[model samples]
Target: MPTVRIPGPPGLPLIGSMVDLARQPLQAMLAAQRDYGDVVRFAFGPPGLRGEIYAVFSPEGAHQVLAGQAANFRKESTLYEEVRSTVGNGLLTAQDADYQRQRRLIQPLFTRRRVDGYAGAVAVEAAALVERWSAVPGGVVEAVAEMSRFALRTVSRILFGADVEAAVDVVRGAFPVLGEYLLARSFSPLHAPRSWPTPANRRALAAQRELYRVCDGIIARRRAAGPGKAEGAGDLLGLLADARTEDGERLDATELRDQVLIFLLAGHETTATSLTFALHLLGRHPEVQRRARAEVGEVLGGRAPGVADVEQLSYLTMVLKESMRLYPAAGIFGRRAVEACEIGGHEIPAGADVMVSPWVTHRHPGHWPEPERFDPERFTPEREAARHRYAWYPFGGGPRACIGQYFSMLESVLALAALLQAFEFEAVDREVPIGQGLTLQAEGPVRVRLTPRSL
Candidate 1:
């Protein structure tokens, strides 16, 4: 084992680096990577207190941690624990055999052929969103809120089908609260127990119950409709309810609820963040906006985008990719070293919290020439092909990669195309500040002005 002690700033004793991490995570991370090398260490607290986070900012280290030697790492970080507590033991936080089994059963559903089936549903939601924006009193809309609404409706419709409307009310505004609650818990060294009924805990738990209640009710309705009805319903809930393992085991009621809740959380809010930022970026760059809109017009020609359009809207896809690079939804993810391992030429012992940050790695000067500039050109085929595979993993990489990636891209492309076809954006808030949450979220409204597009 190469026992070269990783270099990093040892902050104030007892709560080493916690203040910096909790105050401005992104900035602190960037500074850490830029000042220290690719593999840097940051203590979370005093000695033997969860030790220190070994952050991998190099593509090589990212590949090692996330994919190459994945077996040596486990999703056992406090952050993941927080998420598992709030949501459930769904795909995001499942471990070992549970994760493998769930992945095997759920993987087939997200195949290109099956996921593309939801494109029309995505297009319908996109069209509705474009129309909704048209009705904004001043032709100005809050991009984050609007994208959330669109993504929520679209995911709900796909997940719940006929019961879509029943879920919207309960899920709306609940995730942010849950996200804050989770983040606070994830970072705090010591906190009151969740059962202690603190104000914040109460609000978060209430939000969780209502969200779960709505999903549970929908599942119950499907169950009442009978197995035949559920299997035949042709939606996510029905498919999950009907999914069986090789041993003929099906997800129990609680298991079914877990899947639905996770799907809603991951499927909707993340997509909304991607769309909001993509539009916000476009609003700030008219040249890129015109070019992207032109591509949309040339391809769609006033017709709604279909699944095939996803391939043809190449430029727009690049724009979204660039936005995600600048602000990834899953910016920083955590894993624990299961055993001693070497990454980026440093020795990592077992039980250390390992973190891979796409936000900082995506800006590595070695790969991206001008890291801060928003240039969709970087995603051009030739450039993308030449770069390291793990250099741009907005949706994550490896065995545990996001299953909804295909659907997310399809929805984003279709939504962007439709929105571009409907309106031309002018940035109202040119610079929208952001922070980390359940996903990369804006600190304030990402507002943009729209002028209806002429046929």
Candidate 2:
């Protein structure tokens, strides 16, 4: 194989491309791919703190790193370590045997059959949102905040069940704190250790403790209520608490807490982002919004949507897919190379930081013709089948793909369809800037003007 230095943009002495990256990570990554090829090398920081991220922006490269040569990469990035600090050994941050065992036990709980039971719960929340929006002083709402509320409420209800009302406020307040802390800690090349009493660390500690207390209290209540009390209930926590392996093993208390934290945070946050941007995009394109609404109207015919209806909301599903293609929640993720590997004919040194960006790859002109347009028809069956799978992986791809993929889809489709059926939206901000947190966040306001649908 020929050895060639990966081409990338150069920068000032100590910090290579850090300014541009910090300012606009998605745009920087895309520009890099446009200027260089699919594989690009970027170095930042200084000396001992220096970081070299090998950005893989092609479908083949993403496949190699995330699937084909998965064994050669480890989730030892700073980001995972930061998440582990709060989440313990949950599947999201666990490795090796622990991950395999967790996946085995938890996989059953997230299967289509099991998560389908969540549709009713999602519909309830969607209806609640519709009610809330109906009462707004004016027919306008901040799409980002409103979507976040809907998502957090839905996840809380599914996780906490009868006790949901109690947990919602606590979770909504505390998660943003923890998310901010996690983002800052993961990216900070130099900061006081978490154990130190810095204000940020102190605030993070308080938020972490508060969240754990809420989850712990709920778990205790469920345990005290016993099996008979929750027998017919299919809440996420109850399902996880009751999940038993073929050998009759179950997640212990600590493991239960870890998994619940992952679900509550990742679950709500990601779906909120998907819903927010889908709404934003739909509002931006009146024709697309009209078409999606027509599909929802035809499918539900004014009835509330449920799990059974999710699959039939085809055009709306495409709208969500295209939204995620443009604004994936987990826009960028990292893995550390454990063994030397070659991806896309470029040699990746062992211990190198490898970043795979769905935000960049999904916009590849090779896969998406007018990559920047809000085009939902791109997700039609024929077009989707013709494209490379990894090229549009909003939920990721491979063994480590998001376990909540279907659930997110179900929730997003149901909420979106319900909202679209109830109201027509016009974008107040045609272009919303994004800021990276634990999940992608829309910077500033994502405002949408709403008019109740005459139907």
Candidate 3:
């Protein structure tokens, strides 16, 4: 085997790059890639500590870790275990066999045909959001909070059917607390044992219980409805309630709770962040916004956007793709080595953390010329076909890639088109407030001035 010889900045002792990383994560990672090449070694924890991490930031490196030798790296254990405090052994927290089984069981609910059906609901929610904005005076609207509310309402409508009001309070209350705690833990090297009665930990535990209560209530209601309910009822909760394993074993209440919790939390938050960032980008680039609005006008012709219109709104799709390329919601993510492996001529021992940052890789100078420019034309079919396969993985790559990708794309395209049709947006701030939490979000309200469109 080759000797382990990755290069990195030997950071300050005891603290070891944590200050730099915490303050400017995306810039720090990008600087490391520029200085040390594709695979850069990073030290965390105290002096002489064993916590050496590797960041992979090239298409080749990403392909190696996320696809080529994928079996050798698994989701980081400590982080996932922490997530399980709320999500339990759901798809995100499940291991090899359990994850495979769960995927099979839930896969039917997200089939292309079914996800397409959710488009009408997505457009309805977006239209309601437009109406709410119309009622308010047209000053700086909080784009981030508004998108979050819209995403939660849309997902709840799709998942819970007619019973959304029953679970909305608990879901809305629990997730912000849960996201703050998870984001802190994921970054901090010095969190106390979660069992300790600390204020943050107490909040986390309380939030977890609230989420469980909400999940339990949703499942109980579905069960009470009886399995004879038609699959055509078309809500996700109904389908999951009736899903059976290959052996014909139905999911128990606990399993049902886990799935619901993970779906509601993970599903809505990522989509909200994506939509928020997309709007921020569009608001800043009025030309792009105008072009997209033109497309929406020509295609929809004063009708609500549907799944069928997703393909026709090509520029709108390109704008969203370009926005995700620049500010990927799950920008910097992690995996852990399950066994010793070589990537880019460096040895990664089992349990060592590995990072694949879309924020870094998407901006890699080698893959994307003029990487910082906001030009959706770069995603044109001809240009995209010329790029590397792993060049722009906003939804990630490989078997463990996000399963909700199709749903998110369709939802974002429809919602974005609908918003553009209803209102024209102008940015309140010259520079956007970029924030990092469970996902990359706008730090403050992405205040935008909205003028009603003359449709």
Candidate 4:
């Protein structure tokens, strides 16, 4: 069989796609997909190195790399590598045997039934957040920062099973620095290596140290509680602390730290970003917000929302789904081919890095009509059923898909619904610049005018 030459722009020698990717990766990838078809070859670094990358735009190719033939690829991308510096072989960065073992041990912690039990606690926090916002004299809220705090609190409580209010504060301060550091490494060709003593590196290192200390404290306190006390407590930390793999091996201290890092950082970060975007979208679209509020009113009848109300808030679910589709919290997914593979009839060489962007694919014209428009109805049951499984994956696809996806979704919907029911939000700006850090976030604080609804 002839090796198919993947189509893409012929850039200047030495540095190929690096400049364009650094400037605006989402736009660059979108254009590559548009001009070069489903499979576009990108030369990011030296011609002979593994830095030469390929972008997969079509659903068929995404499925091949992410799901159907996932084993042929590994989480060896630059993104995961940068993430590993902080997480250190946690589920997100682990591969093969280590990943399988960790996932098996941690899976029960996030089971549907187990996660449902958290809904009440999450709802309580959501209501408390609304109360806090209402107490604001001016009723103007910084949506991203507010959501970050709320998400941090919720995730900290759920994961730690103890009041780590002080620890949450540490995480809040450190997360943005870490996010900016990771994003810079992912984009800039001139980015300093972790070994360098750059100012950003210093900040990232200090932030990481603080986060590691926080994780260690959580683990030590839980361990001090002992098996009986830990097992009796039903939080994620407890479950993980007490968990043993099929072979009866438990995660060691370092492994515990890594898992906490994943849950604390990635877990809270993505949900916070998604909630911010959801609120921004709702604020921009009034009819959608009104309809959503109506659903909440009809369902809750002026009472605080509960776990059982999740099913009843179908329209709010659609709104959240549409928001993710429009501006996915994690915009791009990357994988490295462990073995040569064929995708979209193009031969992908072994060791090549491959990428799929939710920001691009979700807006593909063939998959979404008026792709730029915000239409919650597009997520109606029928339409979703008809679409490709990989077409709208905000949580990603295949075995390596986000384990906390359900938890994040339930948390986001509850928070969004509760807030919308209590207050009407209006965006201060016609356009908000998006910042692509560890996750997608509004570049600056999302300021919104909040008007408390009459119960």
lDDT per model vs. reference:
0.86, 0.86, 0.82, 0.84
What TM-score does structure 4 among the candidates reach?
0.95
Better of 3 and 4 by lDDT: 4
Model 4, C-alpha of 424: deviation from truth (Å): 1.0
> Of 2 and 4, which scores higher on lDDT?
2
Clashing residue pairs in candidate 2 are: none
Evaluated at residue 281, the lDDT of candidate 3 is 84
Off by over 4 Å in 4: 11-14, 46-50, 188-193, 230-232
Output the lDDT of residue 179, model 4.
Answer: 79
How does model 1 fare in lDDT?
Answer: 0.86
User: 279-336 in candidate 3: lDDT tens per residue?
Assistant: 8889899999999999999999999888889999999999999988988987787788
**Each prediction's TM-score versus the true structure:** 0.97, 0.96, 0.95, 0.95
Per lDDT, the best of the predicted structures is 1
Instruction: Using lDDT, rank the candidates from best to worst.
Output: 1, 2, 4, 3
For candidate 4, lDDT tens digit of each residue in 285-312?
Answer: 9999999999999999988888889999
lDDT of 1 by residue, 49-158 (tens): 54467888999889988889888878899899988888899988899888888887788789999999988788778878877777889888898888999999999888
The alpha-carbon deviation from the true structure for residue 359 of candidate 1, after best TM-score superposition, in angstroms, is: 0.6
Q: What is the C-alpha lDDT profile of model 2 across 97-195, one tens digit per residue?
A: 999989999998888998898888898999989988988987889988898889998988888788788778888888889877876666556669888
